[model samples]
Target: MLFAFSIAPAGTPGDSVSAAVADAVRVVRESGLPNETTSMFTTIEAETWDEGMDVIKRAVEAVQAHAPRVSLVLKADIRPGHTGQLRSKVERVEAALDEG
Candidate 1:
């Protein structure tokens, strides 16, 4: 399964959210899962549903320590027997664009 998520803290003083976003990304990176962090979301691949949710849980907790309100957006692709789709998905799109 592949999970893409974006987490942020609400009602922060500053206009920039890089700090809170950094907190969330740090946790996701520390999980050691096959993951990618883009401008909008972080995509991670996990063999099991529990593994993916556990990573999200830890990430949310890390962000919550600073801000009182936290927001999370998660999208999951539950394709059994699939792996490496994280990178392959983008590569496929790029390949088609190149051909066109």
Candidate 2:
């Protein structure tokens, strides 16, 4: 399964949540999972549903410390027996774009 999630601290400094975001991303990366982070979300590929959700759980905790409120947006693509789609999915789309 592949999960993409964005977690941020609300009521933080101005409109910039980078500092808190960094803290959360750090946890996700340190999990040693295949993950990609964009401006809005962090995508993680894990072998099992539990493993994936656990990573996101840690990330949210990491952000909660920085602000009084936390906001999270999560999306998931659950396809059993699939792996590496995290990168390959985008690669396939880009390949199609190139063909066009």
Model 1 local distance difference test score: 0.91
State TM-scores per candidate: 0.92, 0.94
- Give the alpha carbon lDDT tens digit for every residue of 1-100 in model 2: 9999999899866988888999999999999999999888999999999999999999999999999999999999999998899989989999999999
Best by TM-score: 2
Per-residue CA lDDT of model 1 for 19-81, tens digit only, reads: 878988888888999999999999999999999999999999988987899999999999999
Any runs in candidate 2 off by more than 4 Å, and if so which?
Answer: none
In the order shown, what is each candidate's alpha-carbon RMSD? 1.1, 1.0
Candidate 1 has its poorest 10 consecutive residues by lDDT at 11-20
Cα error, residue 21 of model 2, in Å, equals 0.2
